[model samples]
Target: MIVAVTYRYTEDVALRDEVRPAHRDFLRGLADAGSLLLSGPFGPAAPAGALLLFRADDQAQVQAWVDADPFGTRGVVASATVTEWDPVLGTLLPAL
Candidate 1:
C-alpha cells in the first residue's frame, strides 16, 4: 500500500531550520529501507508544509513513521495527516 503524509510546519522558522538536517537524515534512512518513496517541502516561499509518499502496509504504519519523525519529535511540525493513496494514473508509480 501507498500512504501519503502531509506535514504542516510550525511558525517557528528557526526551529524548523535547526531540525531540518535531522529530519532529512531520518527520511533518508526510511528511503534506504524502502519505505519512503518521495518527499519534499512546499517551498520557494515561506514553507507552509511538506508532502511525503511512502510504501507501507497501512495508514497506521505511516502514522507511526510520522510520530517518529524529527520534526514531530522536536515540535517543528504543527500537524501531520496520513491517508491511503491509490496510484492509478502515474507513471512515476506502478498502477495499483
Candidate 2:
C-alpha cells in the first residue's frame, strides 16, 4: 500500500540549516531501497512542512521509516502523520 507521511519542523530555519544534508541523505537511501516515491519541502516561502510518499505494507513499517529519519532523530520534525493513500489519478498511476 502507499502511505503519505507528512511532518512539520519544530524550528524551521535551524532545522533546515542543521539537518538538510542528513535529511537528503536519508531520503536518498529510502529511494535507493525503493520505498520512497516522492518527497519535498513546502517551499521557501511556506512553512516547514514536508510531504513524503512511501510504498509500504503497513503503518508499522511507515512508523519505522519515520523513526529512522535524521530529522526525526534530531527533533527537526515536531510531528508526523501517516495515512493510507489511494491514488485515483496522477503520474503515480500505471499506464492503462
Query: Which ranges in model 2 have alpha carbons more than 4 Å from their true place?
Result: none
Every candidate's lDDT: 0.91, 0.87
Name the weakest run of 10 consecutive residues (lDDT summed) in model 2.
87-96
lDDT of 1 by residue, 28-62 (tens): 99999999999998986855999999999889989
Each model's total of backbone clashes: 0, 0
lDDT score for residue 14 of model 1 = 97
lDDT of 2 at 43: 85
Q: Give per-model TM-scores.
A: 0.92, 0.89
RMSD to truth, every model:
1.8, 2.0
Q: TM-score: which candidate is best?
A: 1
